[model samples]
Target: MKPDFNAMTRKELRAYILEHRDDTEAISVIVEKIKADPNIHWYKPEDTDRFPEIFAEHQKCREDARRNQENQ
Candidate 1:
């Protein structure tokens, strides 16, 4: 199930990824959603109120997939 970014907390989002980190395709879908929103992922030093661990993990998944495809 996709975590609704508007409704879920950062901690919850992180936990969601921890459970589903292996599913890169699903994460990609969510990443696209976040990217489309823009405001949901404004990262900066002042970003104490927002957490981006899920976003980071999604990026890492995409990068790993690219590397794996290249290696193949």
Candidate 2:
């Protein structure tokens, strides 16, 4: 289940994602939620302008991390 992004603060959102980071489906859901809410995660003056680009970069980083992971 996705967190109520509309009702959650940025800190709460981060904690929610961090706790469920291992859950791929859950992570995707929350990420989409943040993407849909343009106002969310909007911290710092620059983030408002750089959010889309930064989010794309971060997504790529996560995908690269996943691809490089080895079963332990």
Candidate 3:
């Protein structure tokens, strides 16, 4: 009755995990896939010097939205 995780896309696998948190086998498959995937890498701040400026702009947008919400 169990679904085949190997046949599923990453998004489908994630959805499966959310629906079946108790399924350890599916969780293991996702974890292993992530670990084995060379393309799945962490971001380093030095790699993107523009991150601070981009983050600041994001924060300003959030603050402006919060203020608008408060005014409405």
Candidate 4:
């Protein structure tokens, strides 16, 4: 039986998605989660000047998440 993607943590879901890249349902679930995040920032084509700052923040978030996951 397949695991419940909706019940998985962000880290668990990410690992599952990596191991099961063909699972459209899991991908859709992750996409929905991302879309539902209130902290998500949308960048426009004209916001080129802010791209570096935006990407740096994104990288920091990824690193923080990795550290938190490791500590767990």
TM-score of each: 0.32, 0.35, 0.54, 0.64
Error of 1 at 49 (Å): 24
lDDT string for model 2 (1-72, tens) is 665665776577678768877657556656777677654444588677888998897788777768878533
The candidate, 2 or 3, that scores higher on lDDT is: 3
Error of 1 at 5 (Å): 11
Cα misplacement distance, residue 30 of candidate 2 (Å) = 23
- Expressed as tens digits, the lDDT of each residue in 6-57 for candidate 4 is 8987788899999999999999999888888886877889888888998999
What lDDT tens digits, residue by residue, belong to model 3 across residues 1-72? 998899887789999999999999999999888888774555676848877876787688779879999999
Q: Could you report the Cα RMSD, in angstroms, for every candidate shown?
A: 14.4, 12.2, 8.6, 4.3
In candidate 2, which residue ranges exceed 4 Å CA deviation? 1-43, 70-72
Model 4 error, position 54 (Å)? 4.1
Candidate 1, TM-score vs. the true structure? 0.32
Q: Could you tally the backbone clashes for each prediction? A: 0, 0, 0, 0
Stretches off by above 4 angstroms in model 4 are 52-72
Rate residue 58 of model 2 by lDDT.
Answer: 74
Clashes of 2: 0
Candidate 3 similarity to native, TM-score: 0.54
In model 3, which runs have C-alpha deviations exceeding 4 angstroms? Answer: 42-72
Residue 44, candidate 4: how far off, in angstroms? 2.0
- State model 3's lDDT: 0.84
